[model samples]
Target: MLPHYAAPIWLKGGGHLQTIYPKVLALPSVCYRRELLSDSTQETVVAYDFIDAPQTHAPVVVLFHGLEGSSHSHYALTLMHMVKQKQWHGVVVHYRGCGGVVNQSHKAYHSGDSLECEWMLQQLRQRYPEQKLYVMGVSLGGNMLAKYLGEAQNLALADAAAVISAPLDLPMASVALEKGLSKKLYAPYFLRSLLPKATQERHQGKHPHLHWDHLLASNGLKDFDQHYTAPVHGFDNADSYYRLSSAKPVLRHIQIPTLIINAQNDPFLPPEALPTAAEVSACVTLYQPDHGGHVGFVSGPFPGNLQWLPQTVLTFFSEHA
Candidate 1:
């Protein structure tokens, strides 16, 4: 059963503030043990930061981060803290080039990069065969997790999974993010971090043929993904990437228990884009709260914490673990 989420009095109406508030507020710091996994391409490495539970037999939660996010992300740290509190192991998988280090290969991660996720899951399963394992992903990571779950079915890498604020329909989400105040506010913030990484990759001779200046001047994600992400990753364009990567088409194939939480007021995904009961498999649970903008589910009074999301995730994982 889905829990009712009422936004705090101060953050009830505005999506932008709800989305941005928790990110700016301070949270507890988490310590991690970094492990580098060699990419199958052999040109770059993916970094995973592990936060081990005190007990060896505790269940493990594998975390996949959103675009440009790492173990340092607010949600990631908070969840790590929660996992520690429960004496469960947690590992945060840093997408290619997202571990505060530029990847050696020209190819970076995308919303549909299930292969990398599969590799990480395989590693964890092998390393801890006896321990129960669960997976949780946010935003782009959530989309990739859903794609992996649907495609892999019974052979899915984790026992159960949870996805939050995923842009399940990539094209629609992209368009939504590029429109209105979302474009004016959110796009620029993402691009600020993205452009520099693209530039760094270019300087490393990753995509020598492309015009670096033109790529640097990209105003939004669609433009950037078209010029760099698509070409380097072998997609024809952003549209092709979105078409192939979107998780919405494959939801029916998921054979394992999965939880999907989408805030109706998310700035990046319109309510119409969310899936209906007929759209998902029997094993999937779709929880749509009236509020909780984007990844934000801040409750309580002023200076609220993100304990809501972490608690909800842990409870779901506990039931299925």
Candidate 2:
């Protein structure tokens, strides 16, 4: 049986689905700042900060977005605004090739690419060794962070981690994303944003595995991964990547006070993909909300709408950290 509060969130008025609210929703605008990090690869990750007071050795929260999402995404900006009261520094890590610059390596970020998050943590830690470092990853970002936390498991670098609306089982998520009216509505948007970047990589003469036209022809998440994600990222195929990268197997290994938040109504996740509190690490807390859509947890009926995810996230981080 589903949890008592587990219910799908549908269009509030029972009409057409709307992506954006009528007003700005009483959230502060996110300020964008760019930083250049050099390794073997020269990458520029954009950071979105909400700085109201001086922060010395203060806890910093890093925000990661879903596929095709960036620092400008509504939820990303909303999260930055929500953390201002805690006086926590909010920084959104823009994935390679999404923040207006191509990455030095031909490899693009995949579902289990925790190295990037680790690198970001190392970068932040180098600057503030005494401060706490927390991460909140949404959707694809969530999957990556979960894998990272599981692998890191009590490492001093990551103080706490939270994942909102992650598809723990990538194979199941791939199957879910290929069905129903929702698939038709969501698939094109992701493909449109994803394929062009792959094409650009091909133009740069770096990624031999990327077939620009083939990626453009992909129908869904699975299709895209099969054609683009796996090949370009060193996987045999989509199935291999999904099987190896799923976070479920690693959940038990996570030692930090991690929180996994998923909404039953989340279209991207199959009902079976949801994890139980018992199945995860003792330190991991699972919050499967009654409704939130896929990271869309708006509340109240007003011109100025309010979101529940950001507030809930801050509460989780504060309580754990």
lDDT of 1 by residue, 92-121 (tens): 988878878668876788999888788879
Q: What are the lDDT figures for the candidates, one per model?
A: 0.88, 0.73
How many backbone clashes does every candidate have?
0, 0
Task: Assess every candidate by TM-score.
Answer: 0.97, 0.88
Question: Model 1, poorest ten-residue lDDT window?
Answer: 202-211
**C-alpha positional error of residue 70 in candidate 1 after TM-score superposition, expressed in Å:** 0.7
Best by lDDT: 1
lDDT score, candidate 1, position 183 = 90
Screening candidate 2 with a backbone cut-off below 3 angstroms (N, C-alpha, C), the clashing residue pairs are none
Give lDDT tens digits, candidate 2, residues 108-203: 788888887677677778866787777889899999989888888878367788898898999898888788865786888788878777777777
